[model samples]
Target: MTQPPPPPPPNQPPPGYGYPQGGPNPYAQQPPYGSPAYGYPQQPQPAYPPPGPPQPPTPKGKLNAQAVIIVSAVAAIALIIGGGVWYSSTKDGRADAKSGDKNSTAGTTGGTGDSGGTGGGSGADKAPANTASKVLFQLPQPAIGADGNSATVDGSWLTDTVYAKSGFAEIVGYDPVKGTKLWTVPLPGPVCEASRHTTADHRTAIVYEPAMPTKDKPSHGCSQVAAIDLDAGKELWTRTVKSGDQAITLNNVTVSANTVAVGSTNGGAAFDISGKVLWAPKPTDTCYDAGYGGGEKLVAVRKCGAYGSRQLKIQTIDPVSGKVLSEYAMAKGIESASIVSTNPLVVAADVNYSAGDGSGISDFFSIDNKTGQLRTKISAPGDKYAAKCEGITKIEYCTKVVVGNDRLYLPTESHDGTGEYSKTNEIVAFDLATGKLDGQRADAGDGYTISPLTMDDGNVIAYKSPPYDKGGQVVSIDGGSFAQTKLMENPATKAVREVEFDMQPESAELIYADGRLYMSQVFADKPSTPGASDYLAIAYGTS
Candidate 1:
């Protein structure tokens, strides 16, 4: 099937942040169809001995863990579901059209190097003809122990053969098509952090506690770092670093340039893919590496200064040597920043907590990684956009947005649909180099809200959450025309929608590929009612 030619892209009058001249616009051609792409664990373990001596209080300028969770969760959920203004768009897009970083038309995919896929991932999960999907399986949530604390299951992955998910104290591999269990990799304790990146060869990194928490020792610090062979279903190696007298707690872990980097209050450390330490942490009082962003590039968010007067330095680093290649210091008053994309060097910051709506972002900085210079800063008010970031500790964690084709695509906050009491939203883009609206909007239609999953070739894979009683959908949005091609439509049965809606996109881990959609949770609480069904994950596919 051929795609229709799209009108020329509308330009945001050239007076804004450096919208370079002579750039060959991607909207110049029509694209053909059929392309684009696009966790936590279970169980309670027996109580072990004391984890360690008392730890120090959270450093100044850092939000307490409980405070961050409460502020972000409650406010984000309200903003996402309630009506709000949307950032206006200038025109439509043609997904099949090629994209590049050059001000010239010769480049392919999206950027100069980070194009169709990053984070060591492959193609999008799209099938042009498969529109209807059925529930394939559901993994039941693990029961909470008597202590009432939920288990943290932080990762999930999809390969051609297996769908791996983190469980109470292990990683389980399942058959992609039949939902059959394949293997389980047990851990010493619950997972605290998981890298979303998967190497082309199916290996990933994670951080866990050194031991399970018992009644007398329910506070095992998060200190263990390890790599897992998803294909082999085994722990390849386990490693850790120590502070003055105890294991340092790791806040985040990521993979890039053949190195696994982990960072937190103790600064940052890197290891070769096979388990050898590349560099150890060098934490200091004035500064510390909070976390890292990884993929085609490795970037670090360096926090410096004392409490009440903190600052952030975004550094594009050499993953193997732990060397800072380039650095961009965020403006004063912005104590935290979230990495949006590593290659393009996009970082989101709330700018002194002005976003108020709990988005953890008020502006997005687009930088020139080669020179460490800020190219632009796109203003993304919380009320107008729906991408949410838990920016305190997990620096690379942001939801409902995709960066590709030199653009940042995010959904508008859900607003009134055409019908009374109905709500809807659209996906819009901003030129990363110009900090201006791209002028194209992809409507989520009535009674639905769309979120970008990833880039496919030059197109985009998006999930449209359904209305109260309708089925959801997965679509390929033409990068040029803004036209949507349905790839999968999930069933709307009360039974299915109940599970789908429970796994909100902000916190849920999603894996969509080859006509299948896997939605899983990062944490599961004990069911309130006896014998009630609570799922860790629920999957659907169109075959």
Candidate 2:
């Protein structure tokens, strides 16, 4: 859910770091939202709304809907409940999750859970032959509550027929082409965390509360775990686990084969896709499973040691049996770690809270999942790369970083553009096996900042947020030649540009498919001022 808003004015504070540099405000919620953490003119950002204990867990939060950021004809965004963004019709609500496909695409999400990228080898994912695009739809934000809290809308999935998105307390499926509501499944409470991964059969998982929050119980605890049939618009099964008498406050959830795993400070647990309990928390005085990374394989970031001297262990575990197949321990002094890919076994960490730039990362670790051995470690100074990690507990939250074809791709931070005060960036790759820069570069040109979105087989689909006066773009970068093919471009109208650019690429969920692009938010918040505009999501299309 990131990138392309005009970079924050350089004068703003840099990304937020917890104890050392201007650290987390002691009064802040571990890390309060919009804190001085992530410097202004934000770029690819840290994972968000992080749940669980707050020890080595100081990270930033920017809610994305589950899609990409590309704003269009929004200020003219008249909310037509029946004809526009929100439709009452539920016909043809179900969609086909493209499972069993061999090729990766700019749009299809197959391997990575909600966060991983999959390639689309089909015509739907090929690069754009032209620069044609139009506004497809726009969703109005839900009226904010008195609490001024941002409602969580964490999950969004693109199936063959339906574009499923999480709403306030429901999951809504929409017609991808028309941007019309197709079907919706109501939930007891707001969504907490959604697995970025979808099964070959279109099933996924999420963690939510048992009931809506109230003043007395501001949060019921992110305790409910359920499986969703993305193609069917239904909840397959729901389950909960407890350590002693308290329901485990799950911070993250992921799907791996037939297992759905959830993790938190209390510990971790697993449920079969069918909703059967596979394992529950086994509290130990010294360690616990903090969270997991799904897709291709299931991995866990186990935290050990007491408060100030905690250590992290990365494990490739058996999804069904909850057994550790292999494990690798991080060096001492590293506070938090985020998983970039599970199969290739890549991890990011801000060693000793050193990423003062607010990207939440300082290095990348490539390891062997089978033997649990470190293969190579690449130093990515915060000032150089736009790639980011939620870095605290959610082991799988990372953005502006794409991995494929034995390579690791990262966007370079914005620097002086060829023109005036304009800023620009680049996408560069590194050999994952050797942890060395491959020297392959894809320039975002000038004034346009490019961020990696999803994969198109060996190619990569990237979003280019335009200069303040222009519209956004989606392009395909060749894995071999490093050439970019324009797929779609948004309208540059002031109404559209002003609204969408405000959403900022680093803070919105962006999903691109065929010629259509969807930009959304994981949470909807109250307007800071009276009559301020708020949008839930926006859509765009190119013939």
* Candidate 1 residue lDDT tens string, 1-543: 998445323321111212233323211211111111001222232111112111223435321111000001100000000111112111110001111112211111112222212221245545656578999999999754565467777688776678888887678888877889999987777777777665556667788776666677764666777777777787766766555445666777787756767777556666666665566544233466777887779888987664334567899987666667888988754656888888788999887667877667889999999999999999999899988776666677777777888899988887777754556788999999899998999998876778887777778888887766667787888889888889898897777877776676544677666777788877666775878898988888887
The parts of candidate 2 lying over 4 Å away from their true place are 1-124, 144-149, 528-533
Q: What 10-residue stretch in candidate 2 is worst by lDDT?
A: 73-82
Candidate number of the best TM-score: 2
- Give the lDDT of residue 245 in candidate 1: 41
lDDT of 1: 0.65
Q: Report lDDT per candidate.
A: 0.65, 0.65
Error of 1 at 315 (Å): 0.9
Error of 1 at 145 (Å): 3.6
- Stretches > 4 Å off in candidate 1: 1-127, 283-285
For candidate 1, what is the TM-score? 0.78
